[model samples]
Target: MSSGSIFRFSVMAAMLLAWPALADTHTPEEVPQTFAEGFIQGVGVPVISVYHLAAMIGIGILVGIAARGVVPVLAFGAAAMLGVAYQLSPYDLPADDAFVALTTMIIGLLILLRKPISPRVASGIFAVAGLVHGYSLGAVVANAGAVPVLAYVTGLLIVQTAIGVAACAITLGATKWPARRTVLLLAGGLVIVAGGLAAIEAAGLIG
Candidate 1:
């Protein structure tokens, strides 16, 4: 790899390692933060939030394998909107980061197995994953008010959809190249590693 690429990966690894080694307790609180800052943070979280990012990447890879990015993305978005509504309502669901970790691991394993599941089943799986992920995201912006929270969610949706679509495209491209299966399996392996670490972190056993 190029030096610049190595450096960037190193930075990302460092950031991921620095994610809280315990259950997430961050709640959105009103402050001097601006709308632009909120939007930026929303976009950045999928990249910087270690456990979440790990799960997202794993799920994205699985989506790529399934070659159905749109279903999961839309399902996730709808569930996320519902999650936000739950957050804004009287109902409460304690979102432990462990769920995210576990979900990611599941998705990674599925990719590794390379089993053929129906599209509807796959969508259902992704939707459940979305619920877990969305609830956590909703919690993060719980106190940011309706409009700002909506804006943040919008940013999240855009970034997340992009990531999913990109992963799918890359996987499709790899499948057309020589040693396609090998490349796909290798990608799956990487997702597993990332998910495994995130799982450990979520368990508070390591960071």
Candidate 2:
């Protein structure tokens, strides 16, 4: 598709994704009690939340652009897992909408900048971003049992890895065509919008 077409499609997709998310809503209660429960929750939770979904998708795309290979994906996953650990530990940092909103915005900026970063640099960026995103995700299972938490982490890694890989592939493929690269830039702009709105909502600015 042409860049314009891709941009238009991305705009529509963003609107569809964002419209429902505009409302102030809470995620339904689904504590991970059993391994099954944890696995289900882990697989489902990231996409269900708006900022989380954006962050994960943005991460995938950025990784695809900034670095080549699966190592960056693994770095993101591992760092995210570590973030979860920190959240569940005494070193717990903030895990609020505001925090995630910031992380998402950072991803947006990185994508929008369009600067060439080395693989090492990209890996570092992905690690830090993943940690922030993971910390936020850890809130859902902060108190789960060991077995369930294990299952939950496994599920999360699997789902995120899948997403990262898919997004990376699509991004790499699309960018190969000079006319299609703008689509990713426009998509990055959407990520910024999403993050900005999330921050606004978090601050009770749009009520």
Candidate 3:
């Protein structure tokens, strides 16, 4: 098989392994506030676990690569899937963490709509996003049982993958429109602005 086909199969295998772990780890309960409670309570259900988090990082990389080929619809589909996966997860994050995730998602989407960024750059941003996401995962892991922790991480990976895939489609579509190039530039600018904002927040420069 071709390299592309091999890669696709690998991704599929990863997803298949990740999904069962998610289902196995889930518990029926309302979302928890603290990470400890979340793990024990299995509050996030379908999305919590270390495996899921790794999957998300992988998804982001895949999306970055995919953006070079697919259309915007594909990107949208990916984002939608990520969102759905997040909603399904048993891990609940603190409000601030949720805000960060939302901001990152927006940033990812904007990046997709604009010009095609270098994969390295996209991956760097993804790494930062992953840090925040991982912290949230850690919190749940600390408080919950091993099973819940596993499930939560799994959820994160699935969602991240979806987001990355969506970004790929958007970036690919943007390349075809001359007029859209301006929008793409603006989107990039927004990413810079968002990054600045995130930095400020991290430094405790803003509330």
Candidate 4:
């Protein structure tokens, strides 16, 4: 089957699993207000949150699948940092988990395609994903005070940078594998599944 076919099937499967009437529900985890005194729960919680971690991992893999460089990852990191700055500013965006989930879907689809896209185009996509993710991180610490907020933003960037680089390396290395394409297709499908679960949870239909 082609990449497009795989993506379409993944979407359909996700939609079926996310069916409002048939899905099982679970409570979203309570984000702690603080993490060890002065350590910055505002930043720490989001960093360790399963949802955020999953998103980061998915994004990293997508970047790797598309190309074999760190530019895209850096692009995402730069935009995300800007997003963190925006969060600290006098502006706020609605805390919507669905938005994040949708972005995850986009990244998964990109990975599913497994196409070699232009560096500029890939960088742009990663940048957009980064911005949204950064904003999400910022929301968690919006009320954690200046010090914790700073630490949180810094931590997010650091963690993402590490994850992104590692993901790129792994994908690049997979190129030598005889079954690289098949493995990537499976990874893309899994990412889609993760995104679907996230969307369902965000919609409050399940956890």
Clash numbers, per candidate: 0, 0, 26, 0
lDDT of 4 at 137: 65
- Tens digits of lDDT, candidate 1, 3-90: 4434433443343344435324243343215677567656766665544565565555566666754576566656656665666677
Best by TM-score: 2
Model 3: runs farther than 4 Å from truth? 1-133
1-207 per-residue lDDT for model 2 (tens digits): 467545644553464257445633344366688999888878877767666666677777777676567677778888889978877897757546687678778887887886656778777877887787788788778878988888878888998888777666666656656644576677688778768877887798863
Please report how far candidate 2 places residue 159 from its true position, in Å. 0.9
lDDT of each: 0.61, 0.72, 0.43, 0.62
Clash-forming residue pairs, model 2: none
Per-model TM-score on C-alpha atoms:
0.75, 0.82, 0.43, 0.73
**Model 3: per-residue lDDT, tens digit, 1-207?**
344444453443344345433433213444445445443433343244322332343333335434543233233323433443344457544463444435444553544453355555555554545544444444434444545555555544445445446444443444444444444444344343444444455456654
- CA RMSD per model (angstroms): 5.3, 3.7, 12.7, 7.5
Better of 2 and 3 by TM-score: 2
Backbone clash total, candidate 2 = 0
Kindly list the per-residue Cα lDDT of model 4 for residues 1-207, writing each as its tens digit.
455444443443343234323432231234334443224443354445545555565566666666656787788778887876777679865644666677777777777898776778878887877777777666655656666556656666777777667666566555555566776676666556666777877777864
Better of 1 and 4 by TM-score: 1
Give the TM-score ranking, best first. 2, 1, 4, 3
Top lDDT model: 2
